[model samples]
Target: MPKKTRRSVDGSRLMQEDEAMTTGGAPGSPGGLEEIFGSLDSLREEIEQMRRPTGTQDSPARTCQDLKLCHPELPDGQCQPQGTQKY
Candidate 1:
């Protein structure tokens, strides 16, 4: 009898998914999903972080920089902040 192939989940892939879910950046990193766990507070924090006024401590420009920064899981120029449309 042939054994069934078990699907293996990649840790890096899962981390990237979590980054997207948090809508902020990963912990210890600037300008990512930043959501430790999928909870109401973390989600709200990410939202408020995004809605921050311009020229604040971390301005849109800075966030954009992080967005532009390359990650192992993301392709070049594909890490733009959520809802950003560069048409």
Candidate 2:
């Protein structure tokens, strides 16, 4: 059998399509870097919010109270062992 030939590809057109997909618009247009950076900033802010601790108190005494509720057999002021606690 004769060797098959490969079809030519338009490299520039492929690049343009890729850029449009990545930037959500034509390359170098207003919807490109600015939009991407804005989205990234919002995402960063969301992540920072998640990292921050909420104002709600989570003291060890509260945890002991909760554990006491879960395991009434345990005496007051006693919490279950770390490995033995129920999930």
> How many angstroms is residue 60 displaced in model 2 relative to the true structure, after the best TM-score fit?
18
Global fold similarity of model 1 (TM-score): 0.21
Q: How many residue pairs clash in each candidate?
A: 6, 0
- Model 1 segments more than 4 A misplaced: 1-38, 53-87
TM-score of 2: 0.34
lDDT of 2 by residue, 1-87 (tens): 556456666589888878776766655574676677789999997665444422124323234445455456754432344423322
Please provide, for model 1 over 1-87, each residue's C-alpha lDDT reduced to its tens digit, 9 standing for 90 to 100: 555455654579778767755766655575543334457677788776665533234645344445344223433443234644321
TM-score of each: 0.21, 0.34
Worst 10 residues of 1 by lDDT: 70-79
Clashing pairs in 1: 24-32, 24-33, 24-34, 25-32, 25-33, 25-34
Give the least accurate 10-residue stretch of model 2, judged by summed lDDT.
Answer: 53-62
Determine the C-alpha RMSD for candidate 2 after optimal superposition of all C-alphas.
Answer: 11.8
